[model samples]
Target: MRRPTSGCSTGSRRPWNGLGLLLVLLLAGCGGDGGRQTPPPEVGVPPSLREDAGPPVQVVRLDERQAAELSVRTARVRAALAPYTLSLPGEVLPAPDHYAVVSAPISGRVARIYAHEGEAVRPGQVLLELESLEFANLAADYLQARADATYLEERVARLRTLVEKQISPRSTLDKAEADLARARAGVGAAFARLKALGLSDATIEGWSSTDRERPLLPVTAPIGGVIDQHRVDLGRSVTAYDEMLTLIDPARVLVRGFVPPEEAAFVQVGDTVEVGPRSASAHPLTGRIATINPALDEANRAVVVNALMPTREGWPRPGQTVNLRIRTGTPRPVIAVPLAAVTYDGEQPVVFVRTAPATFEKRPITLERIGPEEAVVTAGLADGEEVAVSQVFSLKALSRFEQYAEE
Candidate 1:
């Protein structure tokens, strides 16, 4: 074999070096990742993040036969005159004219309490009894006065008889008559005192010396109502001016609300308003505006409105929070549908808009206001679109059932 020359050896090493360099480059490219890759063009974020949402596709498809079986009815949405309503927070309050404050007529100890807080009472019903020595003294004094008057009348009669028979002096007869008049005046004063103490004429007349019962002053209710509060307890001492109890007639209540200054001009006395409890589902209490305060509240710049609301028995208690719905603005043309056509889907008010025969799509609606039987749609509905009205509950049930099935 011929020895390799220096130039050939160096040239051979150079080819090896080139091959090694190529291998190193390939190894780096394929290190952990299989091959080199250009970072992909940033595909933009998710569609939901962009907030471009399409119309809801909640469809309830049914054949004509199925629709007939469900008895689902539809009505065309039409423009109708609708009143503008404003709902304001309000409070149920006792009508001032229908409330009574029971105060102690005389200073005494509370012997008994016949009615308690929240108990119904009738007019003239005894609510409390007071053991008053002062009342007994007055009764005793009246009796004494009456006895003295009777005695003097008899004496005067005798004196008159004597004078007519010429057995007594005329001056003596006159003195007897004067004494009788004075005694009679004393009796009258006593009777007036008893009357001032709230004693009936019959009661004053019925008192006799032989009576065994003490002169107990019975505090009676002046009006029929529920006892709203009791300030005195049994055996508690009370004064003449002390408030004993407060009574309120729940049937006669006022729905009191304050309207914004902008709305104050629209409120008028005798306007019908609907009052309902804030949290209760019962039917609204119907009433008429009884008064609108001429002055505005200094703090809130609102005008006070009072509505005379007739409530059910023992309902709409005083101080209860409520909502007062007042229709103020003139009627305007609006897209309206039957209230039955609307239903709630997880707090969203929606109506089924008919797309095709026996095919309905649930669409959300923005309501301007809702009345007892109709709803005015401000948006999300068209003028002539047909909406499911009758049997809407059945349709809603079916829709919910289908949604669960799909899930």
Candidate 2:
């Protein structure tokens, strides 16, 4: 520390005097001039950096224990379900009125068959052609009968002339008359043969012009439907009662079920029913009681019940197995899940109940047959429960999440 010196009235010339006076003041002063303020504490060096406080704040992080304590899923308890109806197992079958078997009408080689198996055919469309020698014989008969009739008329005219002259006997005239009657009868028989041969009048006219012979019957369809089977091939011979093919109109399909004798009593005609697969936007067909087979199966004591389906449009198909929810009893209200939650596992159904934000439990559920989408919860789960309906497969792997975490 340096001592402060006041300038003397008469400035001292000698360096010795100034030095002497400064040394005398330092000796006399208690607090020196330079020692009053310490250097302003080192700039930007924190008091924390100093011993007074600790070091500065650095990185931040979350508490993992708090997150683990939070629940991921939610649910509510439900009551026992009593509102669902009975479901019947059934298969689609062709309706009787819409089914027909097409057969050939004659025994002859099939000249041509244009229709194929499973092909649609319209009524009166030519299915095939069967040709025989009957055409020639019938045409020859018609010609002979017409020629003989012309000859008999000439004879009868001459006979009448002779009778007027009294030269010919009355019995001769009677013979001529009888001959004319026989000729007319022959023409009638010939005409009948032409019709039986299935020759149209126009076809006969063309045949007469070309002097052609060979009976061709165009075996046409009796009803329009898709051919299920074709027995007659091109150039193959077929006879009456020889089935050409079987036809079925798929639009008139039906779902058939066999109701047990006990349940049969409750199922009357015109009862409304629900059907399944439970998929979204899957249109259901309206159905009415078609008929009940009177005889009961001796072994199972089940009676066959056929339900006629409504007009179809790209929905159900024939021979498809379907679950039929027949309303065998009264209706009641119940809690239900979205169509998506329920998944079929063989005969049993299942759903996933969210237990936490990221965890779900595999719960076996029993559903009552109600509607296609809104199925009744007969067993597991409850109302207001959040089920893994969408993105379920993502939850599918969650069942093994703990094992994955360990790995």
> Candidate 2's error at 112, in angstroms?
0.5
C-alpha positional error of residue 59 in candidate 2 after TM-score superposition, expressed in Å? 68
lDDT by residue for model 1 (241-356), tens: 79999998777887788888765755678777888877755678787788898898777678989888777866688878888888664346789788889998888799999998
Instruction: Provide the TM-score for each candidate, comma-separated.
Output: 0.57, 0.47
- Each candidate: what lDDT? 0.83, 0.66
Per-candidate count of clashing residue pairs (backbone under 3 Å)? 0, 4
Query: What is the TM-score of candidate 2?
Result: 0.47
Error (Å) of candidate 2 at residue 198 is: 7.0
Q: Model 1: what TM-score?
A: 0.57
Residue-level lDDT for 92 in candidate 1: 80
Error of 2 at 179 (Å): 8.8
- Colliding residue pairs in candidate 2: 72-356, 72-357, 73-356, 73-357
**Candidate 2 lDDT by residue in tens digits, 211-260:** 55455667677688888888877888777668878888877767777676
Poorest stretch of ten by lDDT in candidate 2: 54-63
